[model samples]
Target: MARAVAWRLAAGLIFGISTAASAAAESFDCVIDPAIVVKVGSQVPGLLDSVIINRGDRVTAGEAIATLSSKVESATVALMTVQAGSTSEIEAQRARLDLAQNKLARVEELVKRNISAKSDLDAAIAEAEVVKRELALAEMRKRAAELELNRAQAVLEQKTIRSPITGVVIQRSLSKGEYLDQDKQLATIAQLDPLFVESFLPVSKFGSIKVGMPAMVKPNEPIAGTYEGTVKVVDSVFDAASSTFGVRVELSNAGQKLPAGHRCRVSFDGTTD
Candidate 1:
């Protein structure tokens, strides 16, 4: 009985040591990739006037990256602007209304003095009402012109393509003078500031890793440094065949010193690769 007790104690000590060793070697293979890749395109079809950005150029969100041929659109905007700003028609109608009102007042006075026929007074009143309607019609036309100007400006704005994300341009598919369609891609951009480190962990680590946990990522030799990252995602579904679950870590690359598309290793226990 004494010998059996000693054997069980030794085996327990061996199992505890093995578990500690496995926990210490928790680093896993991972790959550094861009957080998002976008294919930039124009909203309207036109001939490309110019491409403001080239491959490898960093762009900010809402920055104009490309422009399409907009000569006709520009002219339309200018014409609409002039029409909207013109007050000649409105002023002429107001003048005509004033003359008609003065004629009606004189005719009313003549009728009161018994010098003019009632039919003459009625004619003057009808003329004044017609002029008032013409003035209103002119005012309505002016409002319509203003709305048309806004529509023309909006159509012109669609000719300029802007970047939806702040990132580096990776590819330029269309060049100046090329025909661009709404369905065609003009360029490719990748967001790298907040890089993603993707890795798969054994099923045993399912409950051990959680979102918001801190991690250390070390890229392969060419990039020699360790980056601190935070656990962004942990898969709830396991890969039955591999008995592994995927994890995503977000690493900040403020200056973008690190390039993406490299293999790396990550550890959650504050260890280096």
Candidate 2:
């Protein structure tokens, strides 16, 4: 009985040491990737007037990346602007209304003094009313012109293509003078800020790893230094064939110090490979 007890103690000690070693060596192969990749394109189809940026250029959100042929649209905006600003018709109508009102007032006074016929006064009143209506029509037309100017400006803005996000241009598909359609890609942008480190971990380590846990990422040689990352995603589902689950860690790349697409290793215990 004593010998059996000793044998069990020895086995238990060996198992404890193996468990400790496994926990210390909890590093997995990972790959650093961009947060997102976007295919940039123009909303309206037209001949590309110019591409303001090229491949490898960093761009900010809402920056104009490309412009389409907008000569016609610009001309329309100018015409509408001039029409909106012109008040000649409105001023002319106002002058006519003033003349008609003065004539009506004089006719009314003459009729009251029995100098002018009632029909004359009636004619003067009718003319005044017509002039007032004409003035109102002119004002309405002016308002319509202003609205048309806004519409033209909006259409012109659609010809300028802006970047949707702050990223680096990885590829430029369309060049200046090229015909661009909505389906055609103009550029490809990759967001490097807050890069994603992806790795697959064994199912046995599923519960051990969790979201919000701190991790250390050591990128393969040629890119020195280890980066600190935070656990962002832990897949609830496991791969049936591999018996592994996926994990994602977010590492901030301020100033773009780290380039993506590098092979890396991740340690969940806050250690480097």
Candidate 3:
């Protein structure tokens, strides 16, 4: 009876050891991604004048995307220039001020010689002061108008909209002649170079991952050469429902052959040598 009991105990211990080893070597499949999605939109409201791109069109930075009609902006600038006064008007104002000053001088000389009454001299001084105020007011109004004209010109400049980043147009929302509001979305763009693949692992694997750690990523049918990347991020918190942790890996897509949203295989080092 003692020998039979010993044999049974040894068999149970061996079974438990095998189960732990199998669990330690377990792995999971994950989906990959580009890690970013950029949305493009209009800065101000206007009728969509033109669209230079279509869906899936690749564009470089600073390329013109669309343009609004410039006629309205041009007209506003012209009106402001007129209100700011012309060089000729400024010259005329200066001449009037000089004439007022001469009249005051003549009145002062006559009053001192007893050829004119004190009241006449006082009236001339008051007239000169009034002319001075008028000239100053005119100059102030001219400056205000000049600033307005500058602002209108700046708005006109923005009518030519351009892209800020180099990427492919994934979606186009507005087209020519469509009325757009300031908050309207114009398009969607995605960067093509240096793509990233997104994946998640069980919380048990999170502690072992670190940024800059070497990894091997292969799609189910991967490219000929094994693509390499460094573990870019490991999530700080574990997902309660899924009981998993998020991770990202950055990889170069210089040729853009490896597209976003494609399925890929990922392998990280499980232990130190």
By TM-score, the better pick of 1 and 2 is 1
How good is model 2 by TM-score? 0.81
lDDT of candidate 2 over 125-187, digit per residue (tens)? 999999999999999999999999999999999999999989899999989999999899999
Ranking by TM-score: 1, 2, 3
The TM-score, computed over Cα atoms with residue i paired to residue i, of candidate 1 is: 0.83
Model 2 is weakest, by summed lDDT over 10 consecutive residues, at 18-27
The better candidate by TM-score, 1 or 3, is 1
Which of candidates 1 and 3 is the stronger one according to lDDT? 1
Residue-pair clashes per candidate = 0, 0, 3
Runs in model 2 lying further than 4 Å from the true structure: 1-25, 97-129
Question: Per-residue lDDT of 1-273 in model 3, one digit per residue for the tens?
Answer: 999999999999999998776655444465656545677776677887898889988877788988877789989988887877566656677788899899999999999999999999989989888888888877877888899989998998788777777778889988999876777877888886777767789887877888888777776655455577778888898899999988887887776777777777677754111
Poorly placed runs, candidate 3 (over 4 Å): 1-32, 43-46, 81-85, 105-121, 154-161, 181-184, 211-232, 251-258, 266-273
lDDT of 2: 0.94
Candidates in order, TM-scores: namely 0.83, 0.81, 0.68
245 Cα displacement, candidate 3 (Å):
0.7
